[model samples]
Target: MDTNDKHYRNPEAVLDLYERPPLATWPLLSLQHLFSMFGATVLVPLLVGLDPSIALFSSGIGTILHILITKGRIPAYMSSSFSFIVPSVALMKTAGYAGVAQGTIAVGLVYLVVATIVGIAGSGWIDRALPPIVVGPIVIVIGLSVASSAADNAMMNGKHYDLTYFGVAIFTLLVTVLFNMYLKGFWSNIAILLGIVCGYVLSVALGIVDFSKVISTPWLKLPAFEFPYISYTPKKIYWDAILSFAPIAFVTMAEHLGHIMVLDELTHRNFFKNPGLHRTLAGDGTASIFAGLVGGPPITSYGENIGVMAVNKIFSVYVIIGAAVFAALFGFVGKLSALIQTIPGPVIGGISFILFGVIASSGLRILVDNKVDFNRKRNLMIASVILVIGIGNAYLQIGSFQFTGIGVATVMGILLNLILPREALSEE
Candidate 1:
């Protein structure tokens, strides 16, 4: 009677630091993570005029490097960092794709420098710098900042709302929400995956999917890898490219800190100390370098994948590695990649609707769970600034490189936390 079916496993079971699901279920579990990250990962490169296939290939390798560098503890999935999009796009006009790639490598070097320091000095300062008051709002900002992107996918049709697509999105969101809340055993963990499948099927029924993409793409093809120059040449000093990317590393590092804080709050573990911030930073840096070498956007920790982990309560690094393998392999399989791309925008939107909201709610949970006193004037100010700047999508630019949205909010939150006065770790 197949009593050993993975479906029979407890729905509420958590796969934590060292835990894993049954071997048979690993691929399904891993595919959900891939689905969770796929849209945004590909979208970044598309928006910036890089090949999506290369982005997939590089992100796959980068995530693997991340898992290895982190000592296989944190289940973070690295993807194209949204942080560098603006500057990279701008640099592309003057310096071309080569310049963007160089800037990305510089960003990697910046991460390495920070990683070395964090490794030597310890992460106690990170704890002090990103207290819940500061971190909670920033994380909220991080999650909510992308709300429009999700909403656009789920509901918008061109410039106007499309009733048909909206219905599909709503249906997808409903299915995912119901499974998350009511489903039992192993099924509950894959609500997002199930939701995406359901939505895709409905989209197919409605004739929204174009079969041409799958038909036109070849069965197998190699992604174009753009290699970077390792040395300063006679023709170019390359300082401009370096300048374009290096400063933002500090900004995105702060974003990474907010991401770690969310992870800690979600898993109830101090990732900042255990695997250590140094390792995470190093992992992210290596990812960026690898991605840049392959002519992809600088890879950074993705909140979408974090939201998936938070919902599923599955933090197994093996699942992460499995997803990485799929990503890496998908890059070589043109038809398969095209098939995945054929997934309707509404389907992605519907899933993101709940996924992004889950992340935003996590930040609020940190505040409530930690009992961060909003009554305190300083805490109020910190949270307020972060929320407004982040949610408002504000950017502060200095020279060619500037902190955008999440970066600005993160830096502001940290500065406020550092400068603000407090009697003790807890208020009176």
Candidate 2:
């Protein structure tokens, strides 16, 4: 069927189109998307010691690039992927930022190859290969695997856990929940951002916020852009770093698929069939490559933005475009970046508790929504093993290479679903 035929069949989807929303509401909705993704996007750079402004800048450019590539049909925001955090940090320590950049480029290349294969072979194979039994558990792993990081940050105070930090974190969490539940319209849509603002204020009141950096930073300044080859010292490629990080592309590819599936379910649109999964994958890959070359984190479709879309029901492509533009503009504001850095860890921790849990809950919802038969031994086994391995942080190592909790769980779930016999126990 033609794209126009598809659009005519689903009238509701027109609301999410670029021209539907009033021009005045565009910025506000865009702000909601930006705020929804800001906490996590900035956190990636903070964790890996990359410049947050550059990350934000790249995210903006990457997202715009994605929208352009996808013909603005998919209403997804591209940002830093959490999957790259561990490898990126390790690469920085071992081979420096240049190596990390190269590794990220390698990952993008892997995505491009996968996209090419999917484009030729079609997405029908994907459905038979990864049903809800496999996809649901992998989604759960994506969220639960990083659960501990939230707790660690919430309780952290330099070297030890602090009651004050916990108190602030709880306060932030409460604010977010309250706003999300009680507020209406724009306020409800920006609950997380509001919570962060409140938490930041509380932290400043408690003397935990260091203003020295913000005070010194200029109002208007460009992001410290780092090019792949030109920015590196010794000016050479690191094949070892590239190889080490390249394997992670397998994991992220699975994650990319999961994101598309979740989005399909949420939007009630067949994204896999519309733009075709190949285009989406290619768009994401192109964004990642651009980000890597610019010394930013690997970009992907953000789950956090997905959560916001679930809540607000505003999926206009123009809204995301506005957000992307704002993000890029913010990157040029030196003081704005500094101020974001000054936000205490606990505040981020508190917001993460909600965001990550939202992801986990979404996975559960997908299973329930699809009516996956857990009574079956095959289904039960797949779900149980995936959750345990992922949450338990199991790892498999082979010489210099390693598979993380989510990675191992994703691979195992797919293998189990493929090998195990298909049978459902009859209802008693």
Best by lDDT: 1
Error in Å for residue 295 of model 2? 2.3
lDDT of 2 at 420: 83
TM-score of each: 0.92, 0.88
- Residue-level lDDT of model 2, residues 372-396, one tens digit each, is 9887888999999999998897988
Alpha-carbon RMSD of each model? 5.1, 3.2
**Per-residue accuracy of model 1 over 354-415 as CA lDDT, tens digit each:** 87888899999989988998788888889999999999989887776677788888878889
Which stretches in model 2 have alpha-carbon errors above 4 Å? 1-25, 46-49, 85-97, 228-236, 424-428
* Residue 315 displacement in candidate 1 (angstroms): 0.9
TM-score, candidate 2, is: 0.88
Model 2 gets an lDDT of 0.80
